[model samples]
Target: MASLPEGALMQRAAAGLAYAVIGHLRGRGLGGVYGKRVVLLVGSGDNGGDALYAGAILARRGVQVEAWLLADRAHSGGVAALRAAGGGVVKLSEGYRSLSGSQPSVVVDGIVGIGGKPGLRPDAEEALAMLAGVPVVSVDTPSGVCVDTGEIDGAHVTADLTVTFGSHKPCHLLDPAASACGTVQLVDIGLRLPKPVIESLEAADVADLVPRPAPDGHKYTRGVVGLRVGSATYPGAALLAVSGANTGLAGMVRYVGTASEWVKRHNPEVVGDGQAQAWVVGSGSADGANSALAFARASGVPLVIDADSLRALNGPLGVPAILTPHAGELAALIREDRGDVEARPLHYARLAAKRFDAVVLLKGRRTTIASPDPDTPVRVNTTGTSWLATAGSGDVLGGLIGSLLAAGLAPIDAASAGAWLHGTAATLASAGGPVTASGVAAAIPAVIRSLPAVSS
Candidate 1:
């Protein structure tokens, strides 16, 4: 929750960059910039000004600095300072040849900032092609990435290191563009932007949000989670989901399915069928529509709709609920409700949340959680690894969230906290290798323990 005033934040960012550059040089065993060569690709915005001003600092330190202006308009004061500090400027043109043979030690990309358009300008593209293979550092965000949407249109610069001001933007956390951003370094710039349009949950943040057991708390007080999943054909789903809920987060788990034998075999503690505070419905229960619908009408518990259950829904689901859908499922939902919803995830998530009057957790590389009210801030989960894409993982996630909901966390908090824990557990279990659904479930306790302490 730490923040800084707008202008002061920018200055701090510049200072951080100065220190980083100095450190990089020192680590390379270079005495100083007295004889090193640096090239800067300058644009027309504050991004250019940042690089220009930083260049002035390097110029004073004896680095031979050259600024290649890509736009007719440039940062006036920054250019003046660089020139006064003995830096030279040149208008970028086709006359420049390949720098592959004599590449500068470093290149600064200042083409676009946060206000950049979706694609690069013509001249910017040509300049980048000319400087191919040069080690470059991007300011703010990589030029040409969809700053607000995290979408990459056409092409964008791939930086060796990105010096971002303030906190990370969506593009730095989401994929495609995220992959393009190499080692990101945050610079404290003094800008106080509004609450972020998106946010990544950190360990400390999760620690504060997760609930703890009290001395007086009992199994019933902790709350019961009803699970309506699995079938004769795919009983494994029931076991996996139940295993995921066994992390001591839920007081009791109740099973309702034809796969009761399998569920009991795996988790004998589960009740045969009973009332519950929350329900995890559908995971490998393809033919369980009848039972699911019956449970839906009979159970007053908050529900998590997933996999087959999402497809089985017929009318307005009459209860507090959360829908967990990936791109394909979301696309299908959009087709059923709104035509172009999937094209814009934020819009679709908000719309779905409102239409269903329930919390919606849209699963993806960067999971997004939205509430029924548009004004409420959306939560983005950032703790995942690609290993989470394994089969049966979604079922585990459903049970974990259902457990939190049963434990009395609000729908939004339950979904978001469950997602954060699921992702963190996946990362810990994977250890940079392939992991099974059971591994992720097993790691939940460790992840919970790693969270910062909070009194019940």
Candidate 2:
């Protein structure tokens, strides 16, 4: 803002806000923008100023715009511009009685912005309660959310759409706060930002990261992934893990477990035992998890550790590895409460990554992959449906990531890209319905096919 002329940034923000509100108006089929009622819940800061300026632009387009000032004072220049553009201005205190039966087509929530704390004032709450069912367009972020923590502490506006400038905030990606922000639209405001320490992968990023086969590649050249998973007590775990690895990401899969007969019965192509570039251990090896982990460690190759194998950790494994754990397993490893781990996944995941000297993939709605290197950014995956919380899913994830590791990707890249593919496969399998772990595994090839093809 210091680089630009005074009010230039504000003008750009107002124009973007106006454009988004107009889009909502057209999308709703609300008699086109002209003469539609739009009420601005103006507060006492630059947030209110942005709304007032946007209201002025709408008023010039023949919109019936009104500014309801939540505080005794508001942006002086914004108020002047609104009045000049023939928009109505009134203090909410003076007009509270007249708002009972009045209904505006849209409400612009300029009541709070990124600078505000995590709750609302009494009067702001009352205004929101009065206008309960109307569609809202929040400027920047929804009011009354912890801007940096993605937590909702008190009464807040649930916007139908949120218009953010420059970049996305934490509330846009994490849960609770993410649920409140219905659809986020980011507008470029021409600010050069520093490199971020947190990021979410889009399809293109995954496309570039996933390894492809060479035209002349033979079976051994492509790479082989081995599994030391499952037991007689949980044979299904072995089958599911093999299902994930056989999706053709790796050249071949080798199974060595108590459930070898069952795995071969389900997946005939899997070999009994052989050398491998990477190993997946401990999904359901039960009492044998420790031995399985030790055997895989002896190979001096990359490993994907999950389920029962997660408890076998004493220190760093002295090899490239990825640790897959849910909130409960992570809690046990760190000696913290499961609820605490869930609430603060970023902190705990980073801590575990540093402690274990490996990539830690913590599973949740927004699955976070934290790298052991301090300079590497934490990757957050924003795909998949809630239906993915089915049984044996983590087994499939473990095998899939192990395959990527065997194919020569770094541990962090393999883990993040594998996670992105896992979630996306679950979404495609679910299709707004219930999905099984087997169905998710089956959908992996289709998901890979959907990605843009890049040269090997």
Candidate 3:
């Protein structure tokens, strides 16, 4: 209230929201919002206030706006503004569909705010279920999502777009809730917000974070990435992992264990078992994953632990390591159900980070990287496509991240950058077609070369 006039912030919010809706309608060939209908699913409190105010703006611009009141009361000032601008307000207890008269261009979900707990009242759920097909634009967040953790315990709005004010909340970046929010547009209302609870690495940010080799750098000086991956049962994993290491991001690549013959034939540049600045272990090492991890830990270098090795972990591993585990492996390590872990990825990723005292790279549609420090914001990687889910992909990611670690990026940076590059490479290689894991690995150099050089 002290920032400006009592309703100034809300007005700013409504203006942004109205513009977004107008743009959306025009993009959909609706000409403009001049005669289009927009239904605001308004409920108790400020969330409703934002929707009501936005509806007023739309009404003033000649849009037909209807407020479907879900509760007995709403933001009084916002309702007054809507009435003043000739917007219609209809109670949910009254006939719901009749007020709309026809299909709406969009549904603005302001039924509940972050303050409300997850799940909806029976009447609100029924009202929403009736408008299931309409595209929704959520204010702040999708109602019913656990704002801090992204958990959806009950009914929630699956928004086509979310116009969040100021900085993004955990819901915008974390999975489940993030997946529910189709696309997010941040609108600054000029509030001095606190530091983010979590962060995501954009493509440009990844380019800056990636290390560039010195002009006069030699092999040994560039830094070596040692790999202890692949087995007789899955030898292609070794090739894929080595391919990731050989992207020329690191100084040299080293291979230890059963797949050396295949490794040398394809990549003769790879050296035999030896010292390295960092070690990548576990992806497809199968039965020998534990032994390899022990050896890597003994090497006393930073490690990228993935796949089979993740399953073998019993404790912290007593090293500076990055734990790369998808839902199944994480579920096994944390002794939770895979379904539960998948649903609450952030919680488990953070729990595993604290428990292992290492960086946890939990892979999913949206990858999340959590550092051991509880205070540090977890980094979410929104890069890559579903095509990146192919077999041997994680192996490549592990080796790629291992190279960054050897090149001396922090564990979080290495994992986050590796994820960004891996995903971007997958996107390029796929080109709207099926892509193999090796293709993804092969595309890495091109992806790196394509990145804009970091600004001085």
Candidate 4:
């Protein structure tokens, strides 16, 4: 901002926001922006300035725009511009009734920005309540959210679409607060940035991270993944895990456990236990989780630990490992409350990763993969549907990660890439309907096939 001409950045932001609002108006089939009602909740921050300027542009394009000033003062230039463009500006006390006849087509939330705190004031809360049920387009971020921590303290705006500038705030990728930001639209305003606080795997990133077979590769040459998962009590776990590993990501999958008979019966391609490039243990090993975990540790190969085996970790394993745990399981491992883990997922995930000296993949609505090194950015996955909450789904994910580990990706890469694939496969299999564990596994090949063909 120091290098650029005064207000140049703001103009760029206003232009992008105006375009986005126009695009949204067109999408709503609201007769092409003319005579449509747009309400702007203007605050004291620059976010309100952006909204006011955007409202000016909308007003010039035949939109009936009104700015509801939520603060004692707002941007003088922005206010003047809106007034010049024939837009109405009123105080928060004027209320929603001030909007000329009929409900507003949309509300632009400029109540707060990146510099604000997490909660709304009583008047802001009252203003939000009055405009409840209206679709909101938040500028920069949905007001009243922790931009850096992704934490929500009290009343905050839940926007239908959030227009962010340059880069995504942590709230755009992290959960709880992320859920409030329905659809994040990033607008580049030509600012160079440093490293991000968090990262997420796109399809191209996953494709690059996932290993592909060499031209001369055979079964062993490609990679072999072994699974010591499931027991007589939970044989289905073995089958599901094998199903995920056998999706052609790895050259072969071998099963070594009490459920070998059932696993072989269901997945005939799975061979009996032998040496493997990587080992996946736990899942539903039940009483045998300890032995399975110890055996995998002794193998000296990378390991993917999940389910009943998570309880076996008393301290850091003296080898490379990816620990898969849900909120409850993670809480047990870290000795924290489940609610606390859920609320501060990034913190807990990194803590567990450092504590165990391994990559920790904490599964949830938004799965987070953290490396033991603090410098490494936490990879957050934003794919999949709520239908993936079905039983045995996590088993399949553990197997997928193990397969990637066997295929020669680093533990962190394998964990994150596997999560991306697992979530994408679940979304593909579900297609907005219910999906079983086997169904998600079955969709893995199709998902891999769908990835853009990148040079190896």
Error at 347, model 2, angstroms: 2.0
Q: In model 4, which residue pairs have backbone atoms overlapping below 3 Å?
A: none
Model 2, poorest ten-residue lDDT window?
93-102
Off by over 4 Å in 3: 1-3, 95-100
**Which one wins by TM-score: 2 or 4?**
4
Q: Which lDDT tens digits does candidate 3 get at residues 344-415?
A: 989999999999999999999889899999888899888888888899898889999999999999998999
Clashes of 3: 0
Candidate 2 residue pairs that clash: none
TM-score of model number 2: 0.93
Off by over 4 Å in 1: 1-10, 21-36, 61-64, 98-101, 314-316, 336-343
Distance from true location, Cα of 177 in model 3, Å: 1.2
lDDT score of model 3? 0.89
TM, every model: 0.89, 0.93, 0.96, 0.97
**Candidate 2 C-alpha lDDT tens digits along 46-117:** 989999999999999999888999988999989999999999899886556656655788999999899999
- Judging by lDDT against the true structure, name the best candidate: 4
Alpha carbon lDDT of residue 102, candidate 1?
56
lDDT of each residue in 1-456, candidate 4, tens digit only = 588999888888998998899888788777689899899999998999999999999999999999999889999989999999999999877756674468888999988889999999988888888888889999999999888878888889999999999999889998888999988999999988989869998999987887888888888987999999999899899889988898888889999998888888888889997899999999899999999999989999999999999998987899899999999999998899999999888889999999999999999999988999899899899989999999999999999989999999999899989999999999999999999999999999899989988974
**TM-score, prediction 1:** 0.89
Model 4 off-target regions past 4 Å? 1-3, 96-100
Better of 1 and 4 by TM-score: 4
lDDT of each candidate versus the true structure = 0.80, 0.90, 0.89, 0.91
Q: Mind giving the per-residue lDDT tens digits that candidate 1 earns over 318-380? A: 788998987678768656543344335666677678877889898877787889866777887
The TM-score of predicted model 3 comes to 0.96
Per-residue lDDT, model 1, residue 198, is 72
- The full ranking of all candidates by TM-score, starting with the best, is 4, 3, 2, 1
